[model samples]
Target: MEKFSTHTGIAVPLRQSNVDTDQIIPAVYLKRITKTGFDDALFASWRKNDDFVLNREPYRQGSVLVAGPDFGTGSSREHAVWALRDYGFKVVISSRFADIFRGNSGKQGLLAAQVEQSDVELIWKRIEEEPGTEVTVDLESRTVTVGSLTVPFQIDDYTRWRLTEGLDDIGLTLQHEEDISAYEARRPAWLPRTLPART
Candidate 1:
């Protein structure tokens, strides 16, 4: 996971709503065990249409995605977040997001900002009218700003802290390495160290 502070980049406007994990990275792409190489699978179905926002010039390079309401619905697969990150999306702004997807995004260091529907619409219009215009997401300030428009968003303090510090679940656990080592050293010899090996 990478630290997320302030990001300013072109915003890709995804006008459709109810975008589920299946649409994000089709289930067929889940066979691989590796964490990466899912970028090509992100929005695999939508990419087939040449007119899709992501397939357009400038939008293809966008690192921020401004989507409609009910984004990231259905399924609790963390791969959705991985696909988004692999596709170069640092932040996803929408009016609403599925609870599981939002949680997954936080764990993966991807900022999932929920703004008012009006603000989402404004962002989509701005970016669509002027492709490649930069949008800035300031996690520290909990705000998203585009041109003269600025909107405040809400995020739990813990998740914000984790992302700001680049601490994933493993990273968080590692912080207590010394304590864990001390506990392990105190284990008694009476406890079976390992099960008897089977022939």
Candidate 2:
């Protein structure tokens, strides 16, 4: 996980709606448990066609993705967020997102931004009309600024803190390691252990 306070980069406009987890990383790529190698399999089916927005030169190097409504609306696969992060995308802006997908993304340190449908449409048009159009997403201010419009988005306190500080679930737990160790050391002998049970 990486801190994401502010990001200004080229926005790859994905004009499609109802983009599900299957389309993101595909079921075939789900066999592996590791996170690093999934980038190659991201949008695998679409990649083969060579007509996908991600395959285009200018958008291929983008750090932010602007998509239509109903983004990430399928199975509750955390891998979708991993694949996006593995592909170097930090933020995904859409008019709407599936609840589970949004939660998964936050845990993985990917920002899921919700904007008005009209605002998203405006951004889509702008980016399509001019490739390499950059947008700025400022989490600190909860503002997403395109060329002339700035839209506000809401994020929960815990999720916002996790993303801003790059803290995953493990990272959050590790912060209390000292207390946990002390408690473990103070446990009585009656407490269960990994040793064999008495006959």
| Local accuracy by lDDT, each model | 0.92, 0.88
Could you say which candidate leads in TM-score? Answer: 1
Which pairs in model 1 have colliding backbones?
none
Q: On residues 1-199, what C-alpha lDDT tens digit does candidate 1 reach at each position?
A: 7888999999999888999899998999998999988899999998999999889999999999998899999999999999999999999998899999999999988999998999898888888889999999999999999999898977889899999999868867999999999999999978774567545
Q: What TM-score would each prediction reach against the true structure? A: 0.86, 0.83
Model 1 misplaced stretches (Cα beyond 4 Å): 171-199
Please give, for residues 1-199, the per-residue lDDT of candidate 2 as tens digits: 7788999988998888999989997888889978667788888899898888888989999989998889999998888998998898989998899999999989888899888889888888888888998889999998888888788877777889888988769867999999999999899989877679665
Question: Candidate 1 deviates by what RMSD?
Answer: 4.1
The TM-score between candidate 1 and the true structure equals 0.86
RMSD values, in order shown:
4.1, 4.2
TM-score of 2: 0.83
Task: State the weakest 10-residue window (summed lDDT) of model 1.
Answer: 190-199
Q: Once model 1 is optimally superposed onto the true structure by TM-score, how far is the C-alpha of residue 121 displaced, in angstroms?
A: 0.9
